[model samples]
Target: MLAESRFVDLLAQVLPPLEFKLYHLKTHLKKCRKLVFTSKSDKSVDAYATHFFVLSLDGIDLLGLEVYIYESREYTTMFVSKADTTGHYPSDKPPTQMGKVVQQLLRGLIRYYLPLDKPVRVCLFAKAERQYLFLGSAKNPLKHVLSDAQLVKWWASCLDGLKSEFSSIKKCALQIPGASEAAVKSYLPSNPQLPWTVGDIFWEGAPDDPTIAVKRIPRFPDDPKLRFLEFLVAEKRVKKVSRAQFWIELQSRQEFRLGTTVGIFGLEGTVDKHESLEGNHSITQKEARLLREVTLEGDYSTKSSAEYSSNEFASRVPSYAEIDVKGTLTTPVVKRTVETPQVNVLSAGLVRKKQKTQR
Candidate 1:
């Protein structure tokens, strides 16, 4: 029953600068058919999806986020992926600002999306294990690898507003081997938690938070073995456990599975309109990774237009050259819709005299 069509306006008004990017993201989501309209479902939750948001400045990469959104009614829940592919942006070793980007997004989400005094609920295991700089989320400039406790404490500090007395997010649990309350609190400064609990934290919400609340599930190590790939390579064996396995066992019994399992990564979008719908979920490990280079053969636009992928679009137009963030986004599907920040398709063709040459 979520009117997700208007959800675009929520973020647009919330983040004015990224208006064009948001439009494209929405368009692509619709084109790929990743969005679902779920009225028939008897469960509280329905669809699950993931998105990778990359922030860049004038062709220079800033940061990247891989978020799991669990879609539901009350409010959607988001889980951060702690795998090898995310978090690293600009370079391999990102600064404390790495955490800052995540913090800023959380601030926006909690501020606008949640009811007052309701803590921003995050799904996933905050085991807080130290990890090296991933091409994403590998390491921070502060420490090459942030220990699990350090990571959680760092995240807690994200919600601790400068003017607030205590952190917005208070309770935390340790799913450690020999987790002690004193040991966990020892790692955290200011004792943000009144009584820091132990073991994994769980909330009812979506795995991929699409602005709506739904049941949440683990996101990282999404690659499957015989299990759900819960444990990492240099980490514990899980002793061989998967969240999907748990759901299977539960559904096998006369119990609820909460949210239905969906694939993380690009598994959802990989399906083409022409492909057979039969047994879509069966193929998990191998999918066509290489996209066929777009051929302009027999294309009406390509044949008729001279402006197709032309630098004239960028060089001739001031608005296209500069990303001018204009106008505020109004509620109820925008009272005044803002202009998009245009990007010229053929900028790489132009050669500049300022290009670095022999010294």
Candidate 2:
């Protein structure tokens, strides 16, 4: 049994360890340019593996690999591998220093892997927002990078470098709005070929899908106005509406207006009294009072009075003492009195006594 195991030992000596095999693979990857990896399920390849692969190829010191296997809600097991703490940073350097170093490494990987001939799209998963931002040649790449302060400056610098490198490549799409027809035509291919516009050149789609529409703005010398192309390159159904039509539709929609009584949808002339559709009368008097209070006393009093009035006013029915019609407050009603008539009883009694005496 010992003699038989000796052959197995010899075979082990001939073969390299898994880590060493991976390291050798990394070397081969460096020699080859432009390697693209897609996930089995059409999602982006595991970011951890992609990072590790890039780091290894760049000849970064990788100490150990830690694999974590987790079970999802569907009872499916998924595994992820990360660089062990010992391998990720120098022993003497503090953990805080790792951030800059890691960022530099990522930048280096981007520079190395960025496609020279074609525009590259990158999907960045923002852990803070719990959202994925798709970045590419068509969209404003800098906007997404500037989203977080911690990474903004770093990404901006990286993007600057990328822009400089990509500047030499003439095949890129132009993002400037007022590009001439000749310039646009020269940069783009014929209609038979897939239409390539300045917008299409830079547009980066979501991670799962890498397709974008070629956006063209027709600019004729006779008609210097910019006209947007009506259709998407990928989806045939989505069409752009004319600006006039869009404005018309927008104005027609009540919800788009500021308010029923305030924008284009509002009453044309000055209104004497306005009643809400819900059968509730407008609280113009209260509003005017609050406004007056705010203007005279400032915010502190306004807030306190508002709170007090709100609490007090809710339970109380409105009185005719102050009535607001078309922003004017009517004067309070005045009380009036009526008098009763009186007669002289003494004169009447004398007349009756004289008549009795004569009788």
Local distance difference test scores for all models: 0.29, 0.22
Work out how many backbone clashes candidate 1 has: 29
Candidate 2 residue runs with Cα over 4 Å from true position:
1-92, 95-99, 106-116, 119-154, 161-359
Off by over 4 Å in 1: 1-45, 49-51, 73-75, 82-96, 112-120, 126-143, 147-149, 159-174, 191-195, 203-359
* Model 1, global lDDT: 0.29
**lDDT for each residue of candidate 1 in 123-224, tens digit (9 for 90 to 100):** 433332232111222232322344444555554454343113223333344323233446544544474523444333432233232321112233322212
Backbone clash count, each prediction separately:
29, 3
Report the number of the highest-lDDT candidate. 1
- Write model 2 residue lDDT over 32-140, tens digit each, in one string: 1111212235442212112221111112222212111111111111111112111221122211222222333333333333323333332121111111111010121
On a 0 to 100 scale, what is the lDDT of residue 303 in model 2? 28
Error of 1 at 254 (Å): 31
Q: Give the clash count for model 2.
A: 3
